[model samples]
Target chain A: MSPLLTFFLWSLLKCVVVTVVLLIGVAYTVLLERKLVGRIQNRWGPNRVGPFGLLQPLVDGAKLFLKEELIPGNVYKPLFLIAPIIALGCALISISVVPFGGPFTIWGSPNLFQISDVNFGLLVILGITSIGIYGIALAGWSSNNKFSLLGALRSSAQMISYELALGLSLVGVGMRAGSLNLRVIIESQTSNKGLLSWNIFGGMQFFAFFLYLMAAYAETNRSPFDLPEAESELVAGYHTEYSSMKFAMFFMAEYANMITVGCVATMLFLGGWTSPFGNLVPMPHNTFLLGLVQAFGPIMWFVIKVFSFLFLYVWVRGTLPRFRYDQLMGFGWRVLLPLTILNIVGSSLWFAYHS
Target chain B: MLLIIFILFAGLCLAGAINLLLQTHPINSALSLIVVMVSLAVLYLTLGAEFLAAAQVIVYAGAIMVLFTFVVMLLNAGKEERTLGSFASWSVGFPAVAVILAVIASVLIKSQGLGTVHLSDKITSTQELSAMLFKELVLPFEVTSVLVLIAILGAVALARRGDGERKGGQ
Candidate 1:
């Protein structure tokens, strides 16, 4: 094959592999949330299917598939059908730019574990995910249900408001690292030779991380910021009119977005795919077993960090009560946005003074 | 390959603009405008303006359009009342706009369309663009930001219900 064709084929393969893995990851994440939340509430969750609920998601998929897809007479059919797909598509596309592990050579060509490495990877993510709000908004309007419309309106407003804080908070990291490339940011964190270099610990970006955490919860529409889908208030909010696979699409998109937040947090703060102990695990070129160890080492650390973030997400969901709409918007705009702006300024000042 | 993609997006932009003009409801028209904006962003990407493309999506398609949708939904803008087009809009409007565009395109094409200074792929990206903006044109950049801030303030003022309206019964 020509080099251009070979590159295209390789990228296509990566895209497929990443998509499959991410979908599975999204499924298992749902399982994990249910089990964890059930355990928190002193219940067994879904333990019967295929040994400890391993097949539960598959069962859920079948159930959704078999359920009647009711399209109400008043709905704008095309927009209704396309909304969930857009939501899911927007959720999945950002994963292409997230660097999972550092670059390693295949034959002679260099490639990272990520699907693609755009120069403005972080901004691309911000732009793509921001557009995901349209899915919820369109779903709400097309449904012609009053409850769904109100929910969608509130949700879109909340998302766009919180997005400012979310994007601004990350600017601190970009400034500290002096690059917007995800891989470059990760590599920059590894330069301190120990724990001090990570954005959270030594880089003095704790406030930005703190702001990011709070804003991320709202951006993902998780608990405490989930007014858009308050079951008691709006009857399932934007997805109230949806059923079967349509509703399933929204559910999967939410979980996938949560996973994206976890991954981004890990990459930005906890040091992406880097062993904290400083290359203690050697890359064995010859032995199969040791090579596996070497290959999986950074990946394992990356996974561990992301899991910890996800655990925090679930824990926060269980522990905190949902915010009232007025309070949520006020906190997002009046509080988080200003604090994030300050975080950027303070971080830049710190960098300037230190240098 | 890129040419094919460009043609596809260009076709989408034209279709979306026609949809915007044809749609009866304001919300649907807004959505068609979004489609046009997104296709335009893709076109910008093909022209090696990656930062501009991202900003176009983020600022226009994402933020400003969301605001439009919110206002439309809040106000409950139903289907616009249909009316016969006045003779001026149909007879004079389309032809005038087309003539102007044709004149501009002809002028540009006749006068050496562009002076291409080939830049290495990576070097012509967002980093260079930002360097130019922050270093050489920082004053104008700051002034443009202030202009945006004024627009935001005006929007807020317009959205807030006045005290007189609040006091009056609905």
Candidate 2:
């Protein structure tokens, strides 16, 4: 087979696998969030549904599937339908560039864990995340409801505000690493050291890291920054009028975005897949098996780090109160914006002073 | 294969442009504009400009198109039939001139053997593009930023005028 044909098939297969995995993961994430939050609140979450509510997500999935879908009489039918698909598709496309594990040999060919390792992987991810706003905006607008339009407008403004900080915060890391390829960034951290060598602990990169985390939380429309979908204000936010699986798709996109943000945080500041204290061990540096072991060492660590961040997201949801719309906007524009700018300048000065 | 993809993308662009021009509904025209932008991005990809293609989609199709759609919906411009001389005369005239110019330009390029022009693969990558933007195109890029700033200032001025008018009326 031609190389192009091989690449095409490999990408297609990876897409299929990732889609299936994310679907399952999304279902389970809902369960995990509820159970964790329930524990935090000292309340029973969903014990009625099969075995401590292990099957609650499945039941919820079934309910959404069986529920009657609604389209309001005045809504723009085509755009209303297309909006959720766009949201879900863009959410899924971002996973293509994320490296779940190191490369391995398969059928006498080098098989990489990522779908495609583009040189501009960081930029691509940023671009795709930015595009997700349209899905929310369109959904709200197409619904032809006042609440939906207001929600969409709020979401667009909120997303655009935070995205600036998010992009600027990453500039510091990108400058320090001298590469935007995520895999390269991960490899750089591995060769340098482990946890201490990661960008967050590497000099003043932590400031950018902090900014990124806050901006990322806002970007995903998670609680405290989820004013667009605040049930108390706009009913259900952008999906106010959506029912059945269409609503499910929006919910899936939100969790998928949460996972994407977590993965990106892992890659950027958490040493990606590198073991935290791998440098402490006196392993040989040149052996093939040792190299393989070292390469795969970070995968588990990466997942654990990402899961902790995901847990933080749920914990925050249970603990903190949502910000007022004006307060949220002010925080994003006034606080995070200047802080991100300072991070860039500080990183640049450090680079100049050191090198 | 590249040519095939290019032709298909071109067809989509043509269809979208026609829909935008001939359709009576402003909302339909806005949607068609999005289709045109997407097709343009595909055309960029066919030329091996992947970064450019993604930027085209993100900036034009995703951002600007959304703004256009929003404004169209906000205006709530209802459907109306296109009369014979209702903006069609200028539009048709410009397109006719554009076609004539395109035909002349293509003939000149063909006669000059410009079809043999080649682009080196190295110069097409994102790194090279960044280098070119910051180094060679720095002046023009900075000028564009200034232009955008001026446009924003003008918009603010116009908004202030509108507010002043409302206050005067009250």
Candidate 3:
């Protein structure tokens, strides 16, 4: 095959594989949240579907597929139909630049374990996320329901406010790594000192990480910051008018966003795909297992770090009470935003001194 | 291939601009404006300004347009009513626009030694762009930022004055 054709084919294959895996990961993250929240609340969650509810996400997908879709009479038809699609599409696209593992040769071409490794990967993610707010805002507006409109407005406002802090927090990391490319940032963290060199530890970005954590939870509309969708106030929030697959799309989008946030946090702060032990853990030299370990080991480490972040997400959701609207706004603007700015200045000063 | 992509985006950009003008509903018009902004970003990308393309999307289509939509949505602005031709718009607007276009077209046609863009895969990296902005053009950059700050403060002051008038009347 021609090299260009090989490149095109491999890229197409990688896109398909990564998207499928990410969707499945989204499904299982929902399951993980349910199971963990269940355990926290002293109950077993979805245990009957398969062994330990392994088949639950599949069953849930089928159930949502089989459910009847409803279209309200008063909706703005064009935007109503387009809203969920925009939501899901933006969620899926942000993962294209995330590197899951190191590069490997295939079809005489070396391919990184990503759909595309853009130079401005981090900024692309941020830009996509900013655009994602439109999905919620339009869904609410098109529905013509007052409750849905309120929910959408609140959600968009919250996301926009938190995005400033979130972006600023990562500025410190970008400065430390001296690149916005995700892979280069990870490589910068790789040293013999292992975990110490990671941004949250030795890089003195611990405070920025906390700010990012809070801002990210708000960005994704996760619990404790989920004032927009408070069931007692707004029926089901921005997705109130949606049903069946449309509703399912919004649900999937939310979980996918959670997973993406986890992936980004893993890449930026926790040292993406790199083993915490650094070179202390030796790779096996046996020929057959060597390739296996080399390819899968980084992936394993990446998965573990992301899983822990997800666990933290669920843990906080179960523990903390939801913030009031005013409190949420106040916290993001007054507290987190300033702290992130301070973090940026401090990181820049530290880097200057060291250099 | 690059020419084809550029043509496609440029066409989309023109289409979106026309749509923005034609759409009656505020929300639809706002969305069409977003499309215009995004296609312009793609055009910038084709010209190898990758960072500029991203910033255009993030700052214009994403942030500024969202605020525009928020205002329209909050005010519950309905579809615009059709109106008879306005005298000033028909007489002044068309001629002014035509004059500007004529000037631009004549410049393009008459100018010799004007450079043509050679489409290549090379990108202007963010580091180089930042270095140029911060080192060579630092004064202008800082001045532009301060100007924007002044505009924001002026807006705030005007809004505060409105609140003060309302309170005094009460």
lDDT of each: 0.87, 0.83, 0.91
Off by over 4 Å in 1: A107-109, A280-290, B87-123, B156-161, B164-170
After superposing candidate 2 on the true structure, give the runs of residues whose Cα lies further than 4 Å from its correct spot. A1-5, A282-296, B86-123, B160-170
Q: After superposing the true interface residues, what Cα RMSD does each candidate give?
A: 1.1, 2.1, 0.8
- Tens-place lDDT per residue, model 3, A1-355, is 8888988888888899999999999999999999999999999988999899999999999999999889999999999999999999999999999999987765565665888878999999999998999999999999999988999889878988898899999998999888989999999898988899898997889998888999999999999998778899998899999999999999999998998999999999999988889889777889879999888999999999989989999999999999999999999989999999999899999999997
Provide DockQ values for all models, in the order shown: 0.70, 0.41, 0.69
Residue A255 accuracy (lDDT) in model 3: 90
> For model 2, how does the per-residue alpha-carbon lDDT over A253-299 read when each residue is reduced to its tens digit?
99999888989998988878777885687776779878767567656
Worst 10 residues of 2 chain B by lDDT: B114-123
Choose the strongest candidate by DockQ.
1
Error of 2 at B162 (Å): 5.2
lDDT by residue for model 1 over A322-342, one digit each (tens)? 998899989998999889988
Off by over 4 Å in 3: B102-116, B166-170
Write model 1 residue lDDT over B22-87, tens digit each, in one string: 999999899999999999998877767888888999989999999999889888888998888899
> Each candidate: fraction of true contacts kept?
0.72, 0.31, 0.47
Query: Of the pair 1 and 3, which is ahead by TM-score?
Result: 3
Error of 3 at A86 (Å): 0.4
TM-score of chain A of each: 0.96, 0.94, 0.98
Itemize residue pairs with steric clashes in candidate 3. Answer: none
